[model samples]
Target chain A: EPEVTQTPSHQVTQMGQEVILRCVPISNHLYFYWYRQILGQKVEFLVSFYNNEISEKSEIFDDQFSVERPDGSNFTLKIRSTKLEDSAMYFCASNAETQYFGPGTRLLVL
Target chain B: EDKVVQSPLSLVVHEGDTVTLNCSYEVTNFRSLLWYKQEKKAPTFLFMLTSSGIEKKSGRLSSILDKKELSSILNITATQTGDSAIYLCAVAGGGSQGNLIFGKGTKLSVKP
Candidate 1:
């Protein structure tokens, strides 16, 4: 089965540096989403994208966060300034009816 | 805020045991409830329940939604050691975007 794929399975960055997490959602799906899981915490929604724009975002997705579909296949999340609290497992997902998730990118901001 | 609560945060069982995981939610414009299995990295999709009373099943796992009670349950029969994982329950609602609100998850450990 076709699944969502994400690049840089694990990323480590300095606290003030910028990092972009990339995802290639299932080719035919129209809705794309980003979610994060703090170690041992529940998965939290970050943002959702559709029709080439952000549909919704959570408080955690503040000024430092931005998402873009730079190309037809790539959905990317950019964090302008990483923080220690920003360390988490970020998952990209896509859906028509049921959402399918990628293997996830573990971001470690130190 | 939309909320999802899962009961009995951890469960331990032996092979061939049957386990039932519970999830309850409070959200407006509820669309669907989903179950996922998380081993180490990502959460793998298990089942999606949309209507009340109707059950969705795959192999030894089955799930049912109770819209009236705003709850759902996932049942695993004849569980195996491979079934040891964190089971997450998420609900989608309130907008067109369909972003999910997740519960803390129930961790299941099946021993040999």
Candidate 2:
């Protein structure tokens, strides 16, 4: 079975620095999404993308956060200024109807 | 805004026991309810229910949805240590966009 894959399984960055998390969604999946989970917390939706444009975003997705599908397969989430609170497991998902998730990128900002 | 709530935040059961996890949601344009099993990494899809009162089953796992009450239940029978994990419930709303609203999840520990 084809599965979504993410790069940089784990990352450590300094506060105020920038970080980019990458994902390769399953082939033929049309819709893409980004969600995050603080340690022992619920998964929170950040944003959804379709047709190379953002469809909807939660308040948590602010100016500091951006998503791009730079190519056909890669979807990336960029944080302009990382904060201690930004440390979490960021997951990328894709779906035609049934969604599939990537292993996730663990972001740690100190 | 949409919200999902799961009950019995954490459960401990012995092998061969039966367990039921509950999920409820309040959202506009509810399209479908889905269940996933998460161990350490990516969550694995378990079931998707678009209609009410219909049961979907896979091996020892089964799920049913109640659209009228906006709730769903995932049941695991003859549970084993391998069944221990966090189970997540998510709801998708009507629209072409296909975004998911997820609950905090129910953690299950099946001990032998």
Backbone clashes per model, in order? 0, 0
Candidate 2: lDDT over CA atoms? 0.93
Q: Per-residue alpha-carbon lDDT of model 2 for B24-94, expressed as tens digits?
A: 99988988999999999788999999999989999999999999899999999999999999999999984
Residues B1-112, candidate 1, lDDT per residue (tens digit)? 7899998899999999999999999988899999999998889999998889999999999999999899999999999999999999999997678899999999999999
In order, the first chain's TM-score in every candidate is: 0.99, 0.98
Give the Å shift of residue B77 in candidate 2: 0.5
* Residue A20 miss distance in model 2 (angstroms): 0.7
Tell me, by TM-score, which candidate is best.
Answer: 1
Give one digit per residue, the lDDT tens place, for model 2 in A1-110.
89999989999999999999999999899899998999999888899999899998989999999999999889999999999999999999999879899999999999
Quality of candidate 2 docking, DockQ: 0.73
Candidate 1 lDDT, A54-88, residue by residue in tens:
99999899999999999899999999999999999
* Model 2 alpha-carbon drift over 4 Å, by segment: B94-96
Clashing pairs in 1: none
Fnat for every candidate:
0.94, 0.81
